[model samples]
Target: MMKKKLWSLGIFIILLSIIVYWFYFSKPTSFPTNEQLVAEMNRVFPEATASIIQDTIPIDERHVLAPFISKGDDYGLSYWVWKNHKWKVASIDTKGKPMLWKLNKSDPSSFYFVWNIDPKDQISSIHFYLIRDRGYQITRGIQHYNPKVQMGKRVSLQEKSYGLMQLSGTWVTFMNAYNKVESAKQYPERNMFFGWIPYDQKDMGIFPENSVNGASYSNGEIGLEYLMIVDKGQIEIPR
Candidate 1:
């Protein structure tokens, strides 16, 4: 009886060890280095100007991860999940916003990244990818958002929420371009390009128009004949 009990305990320990190794030890890491990312961008898109938009560069994972939904749950709204090259990554894209990364709860890693995106009217698609690795597991994912230019009715400019930083000259430059479009009957010649904006005003980046007769219309509307030119490059914009 004693021998049988010892044998049973030994088998249980072996099974537990196997489970631990499979879940934690045998995994890949998919995180990309700053250099690797830059090289990838250059390889993929060599034609357009690919400067590192320092402000929009998501190098840290702090703001990328969502805050706790409660005490027990840790995972946020994750969209892409994968493992590659010994790295683990998880990402979520809310359309216009940056692709958020998921970090480890126990050990937080510092990430250094560079942005090499160009703004163009011909672009039909935009994609952002995030990667992370922990617990000997690697994961990665990409989120793609398409930008389509269409006509809409012009409307009056209405007062909406704006970030204090947006008032500090970042968006001021674009205001001039907006005036130029508003004054002219022709379509706005210049288009705005950027990767990130002040988190506060990131959602309300669209241009509003008000006619001389007190009627208002949003840009691209049928009744409205106007165009918006974003002047900032580092700020990400909503379509």
Candidate 2:
């Protein structure tokens, strides 16, 4: 009978040890507050005095993503990771485009794409075009040529607000572009060719669209922001 009681006590002690370890050492020591996040952004950017942290997404208890618009009208995405008992900026991409594409290291065939597009009034759908051909030829020098974008499906959305589409797939790898349309093949006024907009025809072919994203139009022409994640599979998009 004494041996039986001792065995029960041993099991209880082991379970208690696991529970205590998980609650204390295994779990996070602490978490950051909203105000602390804002301060961390400031610490990342020296000239971010007027830049406020907006639309922050926490990927995990130790990682987060955010967008910062500077006082001079500059904007980009900032990724932060909690380390050494504080949140630290992992890396910052200064690309003006609000589109982010993440490539999977282990599996080359799988990847994730995200877009925070600003659709004008009457916009109903957004199209993702896979880029396999350049808009211009570069054998001799820079020349204006038509862009042959691979066929990509369109995602529908309502207007008077923005649209968001987040999906994971093994298709549409490499360079891509997106545009807002009222209907099929409509709204040719502007397109974003982020892979690299070729110098060519304005408002002709994929001009304004190409120019709209890649280094063509100034930051004034941009309306949306994009966030990217690696190792993170899925996330909720805010409206």
Candidate 3:
């Protein structure tokens, strides 16, 4: 009986040690420096040829969004995540168009839109939207209609050229409820999408002379949802 007790204690100690290492010791204590980040970018993606490390914006303790300027004068974005005991480049985009990063795919509150637009574009403001198209369907003698959803939040970009925006509470709540419905699973094509429109001081949508025209590279390791450039006619006008 004493021998069996000792064996059990030994197994318990081994399990405890593993848990401790995974929770605390396995992760890096600090984030990588800007120089190190630049090197890592070039190392992982040689085509990126990142010239300057612009900013390191922390999404949470474990995730970071770093925007950089490439040798080709392209404003770019890279996503970092501390996983498997090291900071890894989760995704990289050579063109810095506004993108939705879903930190937790299951949680809408954790979703954020990040961008590093070139200052020369003169983007005075941006309108971000969460849109779902109206739908009609008939199945087994049942008729169903889904109304259009078009929620928007506008942000002033006159102060800065690069930034991040979290999903509003209304957006989060609506997405959560929408995700639970059967239609969301059945007709995934009708699901909501994120989009944006940049406007000048005159409130007219800026033609994508520089912002949207670019060739980009991505490894597709993370969920970086595309933000469609919305047209004025696509949005509803208030009476």
Ranking by TM-score: 3, 2, 1
* Model 2, span 1-239: residue lDDT tens: 99999999999999998877765456444556556755765665554442555566654565455655445544445555555444566654332333433333233232233322222222344444333333565556766565554434455544312222333242333322222231245434233232321111121112222112322112222222333211111212234
The residue-by-residue lDDT of candidate 1 on 158-191, one tens digit each, is 2311000111232334434444654584654333
TM-score for model 3? 0.87
The CA lDDT of each predicted structure is 0.27, 0.41, 0.84
lDDT string for model 3 (104-171, tens) is 88898999999888777778888999999788889898998889999999998887667899999999
Sorting all predicted structures by lDDT, with the top scorer first, yields: 3, 2, 1
TM-score for each candidate, following the candidate numbering: 0.26, 0.41, 0.87
Each model's backbone clash number: 39, 2, 0
Question: What is the model-wide C-alpha lDDT for candidate 2?
Answer: 0.41
Q: Mark the regions of model 3 whose C-alpha exceeds 4 Å error after superposition.
A: 1-16, 23-28, 139-141, 183-189, 213-220
In model 3, state the lDDT of residue 77.
Answer: 86
